[model samples]
Target: MISLRRQPMPSTRVLATRTNRKTRKPMQFRGASIAFTLILPVFLIAASAATQTGEEGSIELVDPKVLRVCADPRDLPFSNEAGEGFENKIAALLAQKLGKTLAYDYYPGATGFVRNTLNAHRCDLIIGMPQGDDIVQGTNPYYRTTYALVSKQGSGLETIDSLEDPRLKAKRIGIVAGTPPATNLAVNGLLGNIKSYPLVVDTRFDSPTSAMMEDLEGDRIDVAILWGPIAGYLAKHAKTPVKVTPLVKETSGPRMIYRIGMGVRHSDQEWKRLLNKLIAENQTEITHILAIYGVPLLDENNALLTQ
Candidate 1:
């Protein structure tokens, strides 16, 4: 889930902006440091030889001197041009660790995000992508999260844990159409009162997440179901406190949970290995960053890691 944060304005304003984004399936490998260590040295030597010889199959997809990231110029909770989002911070951290300058290829995260940027080789990495996304090879998952139910604190509905909760039946709900949660809402007989926002939009002009949050705050909608990271971060910054309950209890339909990872072109096996090592080494710091951003983190057991 990408939230385009236009700079200078607050997070609320930024999150309201929309751009096209898509989700993909899980990758075949999870990050395993031992595997990377055993194979990386050979891979690097081969790549180096290829580069020195100007070989056609050199493993040099990205520029060697800089860590170039493909990012949405206006996305928040993920990235923005001003370098104000967690992804920006994480990118900087990785660049510093790798002794490379941090650079970006700015594009709105609307349709063709992967095709226009990473596949085009305009940049080398995307800071936040779902693990196993087919469009690009994914690093080991750095964090896991889920869709959540959001409501103002003190609203009787705040405690409702699942779509099957009886209290939600009478409430007007706001949700992004076509997201995984929408399927659950439909099957649970709760779609009738929903105010569905467009799934794919150009963030430069419209922001469904912001619209939904505005409606939620204004009482236009009694509750909302949104991606956990977006809802968690926005709720933490909201003028009125909001409750974010991760939808881990859903028993049917597509799973609302996802593991997130960094993305690179599939052919960049060495790059992917390097990033996996970085992620493994910096897991603690990364968790701290996510917590500061109010990202709702979950352990492998589906238990919440942050309030």
Candidate 2:
């Protein structure tokens, strides 16, 4: 009965510095305008030896001795100051390729993520952003993923591929308030019937996906719908087996797939180009990293990532 936006979380402390903060090279998304409109806007952070020239039509200054990145301080599975998230692993891979060390500008993925970090010239990169994001120029997309339907193991729902499945008519499904999968549910005429979790949770400030999974496993909800990576990773981590079926089929409207890329200042075309080349040479390796974290990788046809 209610409607809302999309959200992308978890913790804390420490900073680093490297001498050579040089530019790096690079590559999203779906819908009929849906691809352009249903963007999954994420956050960025990290402080470093960089400053904007404050001049119009010029790129910001970066030290070249380090890879200054913007990221959430506590959002695990994605990123954190502890360098445990998959994004952290990939950022390190990129910095090593560039022959520089990693540094971070840390903040919550709240309202001011872009303006306070990347746009402020405090950090130079956001490891995971949608391809068509307007805030910063995006490099080549390193991964494509879709939404997922999560259910308990042996729940007899593992084989379901689309929300249009008739069995779902009686299920108490859980969905984050503002994500693409929720949109898909609505398009399929299921919105008014499912449980709507807030896109942002104030309780310990955890990710809404976490709460959704808890509800699903606890039997408070029969199923949970979330972004592919989040659902895949969490499902892999559950103490009891869970089924994470990628939502590959939609009858109509906005597609649930999205392409993720690194983001840089619009003036940083040289850096963007550098990342694009790196992504090409390391595509296989990058895919491996995502797989290690159980991120469900999909192609345009909704097939699994084989290589």
For every model shown, what is its TM-score relative to the native structure? 0.82, 0.79
Against the reference, the lDDT scores of all candidates come to 0.78, 0.72
Q: Model 2 Cα displacement at 177 (Å)?
A: 0.8
CA deviation > 4 Å runs, candidate 2:
1-61, 203-206
| Residue 210 error, candidate 1, Å | 1.0
lDDT of each residue in 1-307, candidate 2, tens digit only: 1111233311010111011112222111224475434443311112121223333112344667788999876666787667998999999999898888899987556555666778877889988887676767889899998778888988888888888898888899998765656666777788767999775444243456777788888989988887777788898888778988887778775667778888888977667778899999998888999998889899877798763
Tell me the TM-score of model 1: 0.82
Candidate 2 shows a clash count of 33
* Model 1 spans > 4 angstroms off: 1-48, 51-58
Q: Model 1 has how many clashing residue pairs?
A: 13
| Clashes per candidate (backbone, < 3 Å) | 13, 33
